[model samples]
Target chain A: MATLKQVAAHAEVSVQTVSNALNAPHRLRADTLERVNRSIELLNYRPNRNARSLRTSAVELIGYCVPNWPHQTHLVMDQFLHALCAAAERTGRHILLFTAPPGVDGMPTYDDLHARRMVDGFVLSQTETHDPRHGWLKDEGIPFVSFGRVWKESTQPGPWVDVDGATGSAIAVRHLYDTGRRRIAFLGWPKSSGLAEDRVAGWRTACKELGLPTNGMAVRCREDSIEEGALATARLLDSGRDLDGIVALSDVLALGALRELTARGIVPGRDVGVVGYDDSPLAEVVSPGLTSLRQPMDRIAEELITILTGDQQPAERLLLPELVIRGSSAPG
Target chain B: MATLKQVAAHAEVSVQTVSNALNAPHRLRADTLERVNRSIELLNYRPNRNARSLRTSAVELIGYCVPNWPHQTHLVMDQFLHALCAAAERTGRHILLFTAPPGVDGMPTYDDLHARRMVDGFVLSQTETHDPRHGWLKDEGIPFVSFGRVWKESTQPGPWVDVDGATGSAIAVRHLYDTGRRRIAFLGWPKSSGLAEDRVAGWRTACKELGLPTNGMAVRCREDSIEEGALATARLLDSGRDLDGIVALSDVLALGALRELTARGIVPGRDVGVVGYDDSPLAEVVSPGLTSLRQPMDRIAEELITILTGDQQPAERLLLPELVIRGSSAPG
Candidate 1:
């Protein structure tokens, strides 16, 4: 709270001298600069960056709307958020968080924040088909970037960075096949979800290409929960598909499969291989550590930041995920 | 990005009339106001609250310093942040997040944000004994509220809201006792942690009141991890302590204890009761769902907002956590 004049008086220097000591230290004698700095420390004076930002019209705050994903474990969003924060911090920016009101998908909050000029731009996540926010942001001419790609082609083009869920599923299938499990099944979400459909496509392509049986080897669930996953797994097992491997679209589903397998007294790694997506921390702690696909969250975050800040044309990036093999998918 | 003039031109009204339509609708005829509003919507004109705040000196932003706690599961922090965001939303404010540089406390960021007037006040978390940020904020005369109480008596009194960890642990003890467990043991953290110490005090108090033997019934770990927890549990079991019940300070630690018990063919809930804190989503997902203490994060968040925005004197509150019963501590 100390003023420049107070600091100058404390250091026995003119106000111009103190200002020079702070702004252009090379213009002042080394001793004078040191004295002014000492006075600043003594009085705990801090430079006002916000005032400078106001002049430059750069708040250095990125808006992020927290989505209410109806899932039991929010591990994916939590980790992605942390990575995004670290990415933003590296660029001397901070995240301004707000939630959409009930039954709305982030439009009102985004419009208010952008209109107020409280944020330089925004970083969007959980993009879906026909997302109204995309068209709205484009119409408003607000600078923004998304962590998930816009699924519909009719929407205006925008910068986005996303993980390739299809490739992730293929990689899991290949890992299971290489481990000598030819009968591979998939536990996936309903077809309405584009991302989950993409994952299922990868499973079918891989199964046919590898000369494996593909009929009745997949189960689709309506919700992404362990209970639903377990029920799906039960239907798969009861159908007598002779499946020896299962690749879940999410870690939660894989955990449910593991629970079902344990209850049935089936050794996971030895009798049937299991793999999960999104190598959540639970994957490592669970019994017979789950094999999972690890999304490049940090890289995706960095790319989103770059797209938001860069002065180039609109961009799109699809990054690959790494397959982390654990005991659940290990060859016995 | 539409200007007020553009909206006024489209509505065929003067700039003052447009402003009046937005600010004082009664001043204009209903038809005139409706015409102006339609023009505003068509042009997507939004009022500049940031510029207005310069005059009002109310930014409607509360600064929060994100701590880099080295833990695998961040469920507690994640849930608390969501609750805070929800609470802030109710009050028409938002949370601005910043991280402290490595090896330093939050003082530098707090000072910068406060000095710049980018934030009206701050919400502090993860407080420790002799935290320098507390003293610095007080010295700078900044309004702030803490989610954890300052431990040192010499530190200046400030508004804070915290969970009574001792009471949480006592509740866990009472639950275990009511389930017909007598020799209840505690899995805790190192003595240096004040919160963990409070939990230990509660366990001791409740055990002594119940006339249960307390000697050799506590296992202390250095970190809040499943590995450390399992090791502590192993030590307790190896020491012949006859502990039929275990109370862990965190869900991760209790999970490790569960793994240890399961490996030894000791069924949890049936033989050895187990309880964990911070009723994370994992508590319900894990097989034989974990019994844990659920902190009232929403209430705490509401209390924090009240303290930061209240017109009353600085007040401190310690809320009691609720015990959520589950299969992990069910009576067999």
Candidate 2:
């Protein structure tokens, strides 16, 4: 809390001299700079960067406002955040995490943070259709990049980096097909979510391309939780539709399907090839080692930071996810 | 980025009137305040909280510096951070996450962050013996509270909220014992970590209380990764030790142990009961649903924020971790 005046008094120098010693040592003599630094060290004086940045207009902090959903733990979001932090550090930037105030309107907090210069820009995640944040940031001319894309019809979506969910789902289905499974069922969330719709579209496209029946092969879950997945799979099974393979929209749902298979005395990889998306660490540690689609998290994060800080161009990137073969989707 | 002067000019008022409208609305007449507010909204002017805070000395941010270890993902830490963010919001505070610079001297970033008034205080996790952060924060007279405790021998440990790992281990051991497992072996990390040592101590204490052999029953792994855990378990099995139950220091290690057991044609719950720590989301989804100790993350994070923002007293809290029994450790 020691001010420049205190440091200056301690070093027997003027306030401007102390400031020069901290910011521009070239303007001061070596002896005077050293003396002022020694005084600063002694007094633990810390120059306020917020005040200084008003003139310099440089902020080393990147803001990420995470939605605080009380009931659910966003596992993929957690991994993305970890990767983003690591990527930011490699680029000599820091990520500042804050929870947006809850309610229908959270854009004001974003506006306030930017206006106060608490962050240089933001990394928006889990963007949805007609997302107010996208329009707001674009209108305000704030530097920001989203982890997911806005609606396709929107003319000004701004810069964004998103995983190719449809391609990921197609890859999962293709892997299951290559493993000699003809009947592939797609388990996914409701059609309201744009991301889920894209994934389902992938499944439908892959099934059509492979000449497999699409009707009665797709089922919807209320949520991506394990219990919902299990229930949805159970319902699919009870419908008596022949199913030899399953491609879940998420690893959570796939794990649930595996559990359901076990309860029915069905061998997972042998009787029914199962594939999950998002090759989280859990994918490898499970009993059958879930075959999953690995989103290029590192690349996505790197690209987001690159575009956000590099140029003002409105760029959009959709990175492909690679398929990871594990025990669950391998042929018996 | 519009300044107060622009709003004043637009509102046909003096700068003092604009300032009063923002900070002290009671000083202005109702009509004047309404007119100033309308002009402010029309111009999209935002007051800089950081500069205002320079005068008031009130900060609404809490700092949490995470280590970005690229090779190994800190799954429990991710969950803890989610819980921490939620808890902080209930108390009207935000968490700012930054990565500590690599190497032995990461304290400078912490010092700089505090000195620059970027954060009001910090919440330290995974504290170790002779942690420089402890001394640095205390020396600077900065506010901070640790999520885990420091070394017992330290004279001036600060406020901390930690789960009793020893009690958690004891609970796991007792559960295995009750399920008719006589010979129990512990799989733990190398003896450098105080938290791991506490867990091992609990295993030993439980063994003594149950009249089970403690000597030569504990084994150490190089790291907490699944591969290292499997290698350590294989080594333990190869040593010709009679082990019927295994208490792993972490779920990753325990899952690895299960894999090794399966490879050896040993059924997990029926033949050898396994218990892991930090019952992460992975615990329930894996085959046989790992029975592990669940740390009270919500309470720990809540207490940390409460203590950090409420008072400067060096308060310490130790909460008990509950054992979540699942199919992995069920009686045969």
Best by lDDT: 1
Give one digit per residue, the lDDT tens place, for model 1 in A1-332.
Answer: 99777998999998767766765465578888899999999999875555545533434789887766535466766678777888888887888887775334467677666655567788888776767777677766788998887665554457788889888888888999999999999999888888888899998998899998889998997777766677888889888777689999998889788767766778888888999999987787676889999999889989998889888367989999999889998894
Cα lDDT of candidate 2 equals: 0.80
Error of 2 at A195 (Å): 2.0
Second chain TM-score for model 2: 0.79
Looking only at chain A, give the TM-score of model 2 against the true structure: 0.80
Residue-level lDDT for B136 in candidate 2: 69
Residues A176-289, candidate 2, lDDT per residue (tens digit)? 898899999999988778888999999999999999888998899887676677787898889998788999988889878876787687888999999998887667656688
Clashing residue pairs in candidate 1 are none
- Give the Cα-based TM-score of candidate 1 against the true structure: 0.74
Model 2 lDDT tens row, B1-332: 78888999999999868876875475579999999999999999998876656522323667887765554546666568767877886776667777676444877777656654556789998676667677767776778998877765556467889899998888888999999999999999888888899999999999999999988888898876666667878888898987799999998899778767866878889989999998876676566779999998889989999999887787989999989998888895
